[model samples]
Target: MVKKIEVEGYNALIECLKENNTGTVFVHFSGSLDENGVNWCPDCVKADPVIARNVDKAPEDSIFIHCHVGPKAYWKDQNNDFRQDPKFYLRCVPTLLRIGSPQRLQEDQCCSDDLVQMMLEETEENVTPRY
Candidate 1:
């Protein structure tokens, strides 16, 4: 089974990655939820369920990290840590990336069930290492 972790903001995400950097680590970045538990980004709302349904496709023992970027205001800030961070440099919400690899799906791609499943099920041999 895949192990999952939930984190809010860039700091917590960094911390989580530090400890769970091994194996197949899938990091999902999405907008923060409101009091009603709904994401601020419409794309994220659509992608959430699709990603959840396909989570089981990930390799066993894989670590999946769901990270809430921040409120709308924070995310809109040009200097937000997520945007400034070299490793991430995220430009949009609902981004899914495999840690230590170049595999990633952004924006509308995250809502595609087939793409999400393919990403999750991708084996190490299929991933080309980053330089």
Candidate 2:
């Protein structure tokens, strides 16, 4: 089953992490929403608690994604990796799954039905399982 958090906007990503599920979420920031005023990056701000709770868990792969804002990069590997938007960040569940924490999904405006369909085109190249 897909587990998720209902948040208002992409800016609200951090708040979703603060919810009760208690797991690491990776963020990808690559757009015009200004992060300068937010003090700490939303992804970093939210990761503190999740990291604290996951002390003894699998440390290597449990990180959530939070990329820098503004013009993004094309992160495709020569290994046929599924490429996501420069701004596309994710909270891949396997790490959480390995540590026995449920995956925490946050609703994004870009996560519209259209985007969902468009994104699925990468399924064959999926390095990780998505909901």
Best by lDDT: 1
User: What are the TM-scores, per candidate, against the unseen true structure?
Assistant: 0.96, 0.21
Per-residue accuracy of model 2 over 21-124 as CA lDDT, tens digit each:
34433332322234463313344335333432333332232333333332123222322112232223333211111112222323342233333223322222
* Candidate 1 clashes between residue pairs 3 or more apart in a chain or in different chains: none
Q: What local lDDT score does residue 100 receive in model 2, on the 0 to 100 scale?
A: 22
After superposing candidate 2, which stretches have Cα over 4 Å from the reference? 1-46, 52-56, 59-104, 107-128
What local lDDT does model 2 show for residue 69?
30
Question: How many residue pairs collide in each prediction?
Answer: 0, 6
* lDDT score, candidate 1, position 72: 98
Off by over 4 Å in 1: none
- Judge candidate 2 against the unseen true structure and give its global Cα lDDT, from 0 to 1: 0.31
For residue 92, model 2's alpha carbon misses the true position, in angstroms, by: 14
Deviation (Å) of 93 in candidate 2: 16
Model 1 agreement with the true structure over 14-45: per-residue lDDT tens digits: 99999997889999999999989889999999
